[model samples]
Target chain A: MIEVAGLKKSFGDVVALRTVSFKAEDARVTGLLGHNGAGKSTSLRILYGLIQPDTGFAKIDGVNVSQDRILAQSKLGVLPDGQGLYQRLTPREHMRYFGRLHGMTEDMIEQRSQELIGMLDMGSIADRRTGGFSQGERMKVCLARALVHNPKHIVLDEPTNGLDVMTTRKVREMIQELKTLGLCVLFSSHLMYEVSKLCDEIIIMAEGRVAAQGTPEQILATAEESSLEDAFVTLSERVAQI
Target chain B: MNILRTIVAKELLDGVRDRRSLFSAFLFPFLAPLFIYGLMTLVIQQNTETESITLPVINADAAPALVAHLKEAGFIIEAFEGDPEAEVAAKTVELVLSIPIDYQKTMAAFETTRVTIIHDGSRNDTSATVRQVRNLVRIYSSELNALRLVSRGVSPKLMRGLQTENGDIASDEQRAANFLSFVPIYVLMAAFVCGLGLAIDQTAGERERRSLEPLLINPVSRLSIVFGKCLAASIVAALGMLITLGMCLGAMLMLPIDELGIRFSLKAQQVVGLIMAILPIPLLASSLQLLLGLFAKSFKDAQSYVGFLVFIPVVPTLVMNFLPFATSFWMYFVPVFGQSIMMKEILGAEPVPLLAYPAAALPTLLAGLLVCWLTSRLLDQERVIQS
Candidate 1:
């Protein structure tokens, strides 16, 4: 489980996050829906212990990230926004390296890597260098590397952005599989339909604050709109008026 | 420690597979020794080849005996009718020997015969030739005087009052050291440049690729990452320095410097001593490079910064090698300068002063650690990652 409370962050004179709070329970997929510059990336970054928040606290499985980042990070697998792959390294090497960083033994790394490769259907390109991989292949490698050590919680920023329809379906399938396995998965995206399709709970952010948080039907009920898209637009317009 | 080791292993694997980094680290260091050896060979060849000495003798008939003696001494006597001064000024002839019309009259009167040897003073190649001709004339004049004294039934020994003998106190090794003065400068430069590619690749290159953020999100400490990357770069730097030192030693031993009457040989002990003295330098170089890379916003910026940093070590080498000031113990406290001075001592086979090695090493080690600490702090800063 992952918990964030009263997250507040600012850079210079611009405030990025203000009074943002949410909870992502295990065995569920929580999607953070926000437009550009809505502080989705910043909140996720703070939760992953990559950056510190001015006034907030994030906990991964009851361990506070700010107080003990190493211990907190050990329980979380983060795929940062626009993460780069080492061109000279293969998918297998990438998995092994992250596994070692997570303190996995050689045998465990090998066994877990083989399992992930099979599950992700990446056995064909497992040994090939990632220099010229397709976008879908690269995404699979990134997701597999993040999941190599089998952390209890997974955080991904813009996981399906800029992917083809086929690759997006593959990623959605993988997220569903994680949900079935009882892993708390938190992902951020701007796609309304993708969020409506995959997210068990949706948190809509506007102007660095949580505009609404609920299931799809609850969000529609709160906005008094018939479609999820109309509900998001109506909610965003309300935040804009403020 | 375990995390540091794992990071280092990954870095080494990445570096070894990078052709650009491997090329700069392994292949560039050999150029220094090859360049120095090539120049040395050219100089030796130029010094060994003999050229015949030629001179234009003006008014040749005035002093037949002197001219005959000059001819007997293997001088290629040429006859020139023009003014000797103009001929030398025009560079038509390298030298001119002008004997006055009354040369034999002065010689027969038992007086000193004045002979003028004219050559351009600005020409270095002519200096040796002028000295040769001057010595020949002096010897002939002295012989004639001795004959006259013996013919008059007087001993020639009575005319001599003071005898001067010349002695050279410079040892052969000292001369050889002078010949090989550029070695220390090249070795230090090698230490700085060999690890440059790896350092920038591991730090700035990783940032440019966008891999640093995800890697940092793992549970590893910032210090471990810094230490591992610095260690990997230093290994490459130190190995390049050692290879350069070896190539220099090999060139010195393989060349015919011994045939030039100079004692030039590198002992096994000297090689070991040099390695010991130079081992700490790569750590210092690698840290400086890493620090610069961390501060730089892009890989190209880091590369240009590192390119300019290489001259830092060379500046002290130039001052120490060329200046005439006495080397005090405090010189060993300076970073690159100290290493350079110590290398000179090791090459000359001099007995190094006590505490000099540690004094040279401790400052660099401390500076390296300080920069490494600063790098770790930078890793924690938001500016480095955001940039």
Candidate 2:
């Protein structure tokens, strides 16, 4: 389980996140929603220990993300935007490299890579350099990089942004699969339908603050609407009024 | 350790693959010497042209024998119609030889009659030609004195002066070879140039690509991470210098045998001394470059910042020319200054004092490490890395 309290972060005078707090509980998909400047990515980045919060902390299984980030991060996998790959590395080489970073031996990395390749259907391109891959292909390779070590949580920011419908389905299926394995998955996205379909719980952020947090049905009911689309419209309208 | 190996492997693979490093590390060193050397050779050949000395004169010597001998020694005999002063302004001749009116009369009494030779000092070759002509005139006049003494029945051997030729043993080839101060300035340059691409790519390239975050998230010490990258950069730079040295030695050895009379290539000991002197320059340069590149935002930013990198190697070379710093064994341990002095030593000059090499080099290496530590601190700062 994860817990966050009073997280604050800023870039110079412009605050990216202010007094924000949320958690991705064990075995649940927590969708973080926001408009362009909503701090979802910043919050997720902080939670993944890729950054520090100016005034608070997030913990996974009681281990502080800020203080023991590597330990906290070792318990989770992160696929940051741009699908960070070394470009020159083949899929197997890339997987082996990240595995080594987390302190896995060559044998262990090799063992884990085989399993991931089979599961992700990435066997065909395992030996090909990631530089030549399409956007969707690179994303799967990145996902494979994160999953090779099999962390208990996964923090993916806009993981399906430029994917085809089939690949998008493939990625959402992977997230569902992680959730089934009792992994705490925090999904940050800008699309309302993407959140409504995949998330058990959603947190909407606006102007460096947490605007709302609840399940899809509950957030819809709070907007006094039936469907997620109309509910998002109502919630945004209310946010504008504020 | 595994992280370092992995990172180093990645760096090497990337470095070798980069077209920029390939050019700077392997290609540039070869072409640099050819262009500079070829250009210098062309200039020297054009400047040192040989031609006969032209002597414009009004001979006042009563002995016509002296005049005949002088003309035979390759001096173009131009008999002036009037005063030497009038000949200069009209530009009738390039030089004027003004022999005293009673030259032979004074010579009979063993009193030397001086000749005033005039030529345009602004013309570079004129002075050399004038000096050559003066020597010929003296020698020819000396020959007449010997003949006059022989005719008068005085001992000819007594008038014959002692003759000696002072010559050094070093061949023209050896002198030319030794002329190159072996200024391992190239070594220092090799270090910086080789490290340039690696340093820029490791820090600024990561920032530009937006991939620094993922690496930063790894639960490793920031110092460890920086050390790993710095280690790779240092190695890359050192390798570049070695490649440069190889090309330089190759070029020296391949110099046409007939063109250069002596072995222009460095001796094994000289090569060792050279390598020893410049060995640390790359380490120091790469460490500093990495630190500087980290402050930049992009490859272009890193490259522009490197405009200042030129100062690192140049300042020492420039400084030493004015302030004569004695080379000590302790000095070779300092960065650029040590390397520069060591090169000055290997120029077939005196060997560097033993203790002074390390005394100079240790502090420089320490300073390099200190700068690298500062860069590590910058890596920890979010603001610095983000930009």
Best by TM-score: 1
lDDT of 2 by residue, B1-387 (tens): 888888777777777777765676655566666655575465344344334555667763454665666667756566665665555655566678776778767877878767777666666535666667678777876776787788889876896578678687865444544444332556567777777887787888877766677777666667767777877888878887887777666655555433434435456887776676666666678778888788876679889986578566666666765675554455566568777766656644355665655665676678778877888888767766664
TM-score, chain A, per candidate?
0.98, 0.95
**What do the candidate models score in CA lDDT, each in turn?**
0.88, 0.74
Q: Lowest summed-lDDT stretch of 10 residues in model 2 chain A?
A: A233-242
True contacts kept of 2: 0.46
Which is the leading candidate under lDDT?
Answer: 1
Question: Candidate 2's chain A scores what TM-score?
Answer: 0.95
For model 2, how does the per-residue alpha-carbon lDDT over A1-242 read when each residue is reduced to its tens digit?
Answer: 87788999988899787788887788999988878777888887788776789998999889998888778888878888766667766899878877888888889999999999998999899998877788778888888888878888788888888788989999999999999999989888889899988999998877777767899878877888888877776776676576
* lDDT value for model 1: 0.88
Highest DockQ model number: 1
lDDT of 1 by residue, B4-33 (tens): 888889888888889876985777678879
Candidate 2: regions farther than 4 A off: A233-242, B36-178, B249-267, B328-333
The CAPRI classification for model 1 reads as medium
